[model samples]
Target: MTAGTKPVGTKTADAVVIGGGIMGASAAHFLARRGFGRVVLLEKGRLAGVSTGHSAAIVRTYYSNSITLELAKRALHMFENDRDLLGGDCGFRPIGFLLLIGERLRAAGEHILESERRHGLHVERLAVENVAELAPPLSLDGVSYGILEPRSGYADPTRTTENLVAAARPWGLEPRAGVAATGIRLHGNQAVAVETEDGTISTNVVVNAAGPWAGQVGAWLGLRYSLRWSRESDLLVEKPADFGELPVVSDPGLRVYLRPCGEDRIIAGLGAPKDIEPVDPDDCDPGLDPEMRERIERPLFERLPALSRARHLGGYASLYTITDDWHPIVGPEPGLEGYYAFFGGSGHGFKLGPPIGEALADVICGETPEIDLAPFRPGRFIDGEPLTSAWGEGNRG
Candidate 1:
C-alpha cells in the first residue's frame, strides 16, 4: 500500500478518515487495529507531505495540563517501542529535552514542574550550573533555572506517519494518497459517505483530521470551525565537527527551540508566543522567508556560539492550524453523530498525534480510553471551557 499507488474507488467502509497527516494516519491505523473493519484514509498529497513533514518533531512531556501530559507520556512510549507498538522504527532519538527558564518565566516554569512532578512524570529541576553540565553550548545568561525530561527527545515525522499507515495495511486500512475528500454525504445529521476526487466511500463514521483544510471540510457539512492559519518556519544549520552532542532545547528567553536533526545538522525554529503571520494554506510560500533567518538564528547563535561558523543549509515554511485557545479540537462533535473533529494541532501535534488517535479509536468504538479526551472536545470553545496553559497563549501547552 505505497503512497499514490492507486485511487480508492467507490466502496463501503466502516470508517473514512480525511487528511493523511499524522492525525489521520494514526486514527486510521488505530481504527483498523481495533478491528473496526474496512477503514479508509484519504490524503490530497502524500502522507506527512504538509505540516507534519515540516514539524520540528520534538517529543517531550513538559506539558502544563494533565490530559496533554498523559498523552505525551504515552506518545513517548509508542515512539520508544515503535517496533512493537507502531509497527516500525520511527527514528526516535532519546537525547533528552531541556527547557530553559529565564527570570521572567520562573514562576510559570515552576508551575509546570510542579504539575509534571504531581503527575509522576520523570523531571529534574536544574540550576544554571547543572544546565551547563547537560548542554555545554547553551549560554544561560538570563536563565533562572531549567526543567529536564530525561526520557524525552524527538522522532522523524515523515517516517512516523508512513509507518503508521503501513502497519495498518494488514488490518484492512486502505490509504488513498493524492485523493482529496471534496465533501461528506449525510442523512438526517449522520455522515453516510465521503465524496472524493476519485470516487466515494460510504461509511457510517467519518473523522475530520484535515489539518489546515479542516475548515473547508467542515464547511461541507454546514459546520464551521474557528481555525486560523500561520506560516511557521524552521531552519537547518550544518554542525561543526568539533561541536558535541546536544539535547532538544527550548529557550523561553529567546523564543526559539533547537534540536539535532542528525549527526551533522541542527534544526532551529521560532518558538510560540510570537506574532502570528496569517497565511492561506494553499497560496503560502514553502520557502523560508529571508527575515526568518535572523529571528531563528539570533537566538540559536546566542545559545550555541559555535554555530556562528556553521553553514546555512537552507530551510522551509509550513502551516500551523491554530485554534483560538492554542489547543487542538478533538473528540466527537455534539450534534454530528458518527463524525469527529481531530484537527488543529496548533504547534505540538507531532508528539501527541499517535496516542490521541489511539484514544480517539477507543472512544469511537464505545470503549473507555486510557486517557480522557473530554478536555479537548470541539464544543469546549463554545461552552467557554478553552484549556489554558501556564505559558499563556502559545504552543507551550
Candidate 2:
C-alpha cells in the first residue's frame, strides 16, 4: 500500500463502486445508508474531476415522458433540501428553466406537458407575451410559446459531488481515489475481480458508473454495447451585470442553452451535431470554432442583446456516452449477472444522479426501486425497442 492506501487483502464486500463521479459517489453513499457495509468506491482520477466537473449542472423536469419527469421531480426535491437529504448544502439555485419553442416544436411541447401532468410536475405553457414578461429583455418576435418549469434550476456539480463524497466518508464506506480499473477477471461467466493499474480488487457486485468509459468496462466482462461518445462544446462567458439575472435559457431551435453562474458568469453549450465525432470521455479539447460561435451567438444576441459585450472565458469539453436512443442505459447488462452498469448518460447524468443513485442502491439491495427502472434497462436494445427522444419539434428546430 502506498502512503495511506488501504492494504490489498482478500477483503470482500457486498459491493464495489467504480468511477467516482456524481453517479458513483452518490451510489456509494446510498448503498451504505441502505445497510450495505464494506462498500468501496474506486476512482481512476480525482473524485468528481472528470465529466462531473465540466457539467453545465442545469436541472429541469421538462420532458415528453412520465418516467423522466418523475426522475427529475424527485431529484429536484432532493437538491432543494440536500442538507437534509445528503447532509449538506449542494449550492442549488432555483433559477428556473425556460424552453423557447418555435412553430416546429409546438407538438413536442404539448406532448411534454401531458407527460408532466401525469407525473404531477407543475409547469406552464406560456404565451409569447407572458414569456416576454418573465424576461423583459428577451425578444419573442419569432417565438411560438415557452415551456416554463418553475421548480427546475441549476446547481454546482463539482461542489455537489464533493459534498456527497464527504457525506459518504462517515458512513464507513472507503473511497479510493486515483485508481484506474484496467480490466476484469472472470470465471465461468461471472466477474470475480476487477484489475486496476495499482492493484486488484475482489468483488462480485460492481457498479460500473464509469460514465464515458462504461462501454470499455462492459467489454471487459464480455458484453457488447452500441454506445457512442460525443463532446459538449461549452463556453463560459463573463457577462456584464445587466445580463446576469436571466434564468437558465434553452433555445431548441438554435440548439443552445445558457445558465447563470455566480453573479457575473454564465455557462453555455451548443447541441451536438449529427456529424460530430464521438469523443473519448477521458480526453477533451475545448477550442473555439468560428462557425460554432456564429451559430451559438445568433439567438443569444437576440434574447440577451447586452451579452454582446460579454467576454468569452474560453470553455471545457465533457465526454458523453450515448446510445441510439438519447435516454441512458441503467441497470445490469444483459448476460452479465452480478454486475451492474450505468452509462450512456448523454448529458443528463448529473441532475439525475441523486435519485438514480438511490434507485440503484435499492436495486442492488434486492428492493424494488422507487421509480420503475424497466424503461431504462440495458437490454432494451436487444428487443429492438429503444426509448424514443422526448425532445420535441421545439428542440428539433
Candidate 3:
C-alpha cells in the first residue's frame, strides 16, 4: 500500500527481517551490506512507527556490563558515520551523557567506570559538586557521585531507522511495509520461509526484531522466549530559555533520565525502574497517563528546578521488550537453524540496535562477530547463566 513495501507471495529472499523498527532495519542494512542476497524486510506498519518512533532515542555507553557497553560504543561510531557509511544522516548529536548514582550504587558505578576505562573510553568519575557544572539549577541532595561520557548524546529514532531502510535499498534489501508476517515456515528445524499476509517468501534465515511483538513471533517456531513487556513513558516540556544546553542525565537515584529536546525543549522519563507495568503489547494504549505524569514531574522538578518553570508539552508511552536480566537476547536460537533471537531490549534498544544488528548479521553469515555474542545467547537463560549486572540495575545494561 505504502510505496515503501512490496506485495509478497512469489518473492523469495536469502533472509527475511521482520519488524521495521530500528532493530530490523539495522539488521537488514548490515545483512545486505554483508553480501547477503535478496534480503526482504517485513513490517506490519510504517518504518520506525512503533516503539522506535516513540523511543527517547538516547545513545550512550554507560553500562554495567562490558558486552552492552561494547555494543553501545560501536553504535556511536555507526551513528557518527551515518552519512558516509550508513547511507543517510542519522541526526546524531554528541552533546554528552551523565550518570548519577547514590551511595548505594557508588561502588557498582565505580566498577563499571573501571571497565569503561579499560575499554579505552573517555569518561570521568566526578564528585557530587561537579554534577552542578553539567546540569545547572539541579539538586544533588541524595546523589553521591557521577560518571560523564562527553561523547555520547541522542539521535532521531524515526530518521535513523528510515535511513537504515534507505541505506539497504541499493544493497538489495526489499522492505515491505504494512505487510505482517503471519508465521514461519519450517522444514524440519530449518526456517524455510516466512508466511506473510501478501504471500509466502521462501527464506533460510529470519531475524525476530519485533520488539514487544517478538514473543508472539517466537511462538510461531514453538520457541518460548522469556520476554516481558513494560509500558515506558516519557514527557517533553519547553526548556527554560536560560537552561541553554544540558547533558543527557541518567540518575538511578531519582529513577529518571533527562535529555535535551532540540534547543528549546527538555525530555524526561523514568529510568530503568523495576516496578514495570506489565502490559499486552497488542492491546494496551501507549499514551502517557496522568498518574504517570505526576510520577515523572515530582523528581523532574526536584532535579532541575528551572525546568518546572517551562511550559508543559505533550509526551507518549511505548513498550519495552524486557528480558529477565534486563539485557537483550541476540544470537542463534538453539536447535533452530537460520533463526536468530534479536529482541528483548529491556529498555536500552535505541543505542544498541546498530552494533547488535551488525553482530547478529555476522553470526548468521557464519563469520565471527568483532565482539563475542555468547554472553547474549538465548540459551544462557536456560543454562542458568542469565546475564547479571552490577548493582542489579534494570536498564543500565
- Candidate 1 worst ten-residue window by lDDT: 1-10
Model 2, residue pairs in steric clash: 105-393, 105-394, 229-278, 253-397
Rank by lDDT, highest first. Answer: 1, 3, 2
Q: What local lDDT does model 2 show for residue 170?
A: 70
Model 2: lDDT to the true structure: 0.77
User: Which residue pairs show collisions in model 1?
Assistant: none
Candidate 3 vs. true structure, TM-score: 0.95
The models' CA-based lDDT, in order, is 0.90, 0.77, 0.85
lDDT of 1 by residue, 331-388 (tens): 8887888899999999889889999999999999999999999999999988899898
Clashes (backbone N, CA, C under 3 Å), per candidate, total: 0, 4, 0
**What's model 3's overall lDDT?**
0.85
Instruction: Give TM-scores for every candidate, taking all chains together and pairing residue i with residue i.
Output: 0.96, 0.92, 0.95
Better of 1 and 2 by lDDT: 1
Off by over 4 Å in 1: 1-9
Q: Model 2, 1-397: lDDT tens per residue?
A: 2322334564566678889998888888898888788788889888888778888888888766666677888999999889977658888899888988888777877887778877888888899998888877676766899989887889888889888878877776788898888877666566667777767777777888888788788887767888777766677778776542677888776666888888878777775223345666555665656666666677677767777778977776667667767677789766665788776667778888888888988998899998987788888887887776546221211
Pick the winner on lDDT between candidates 2 and 3.
3
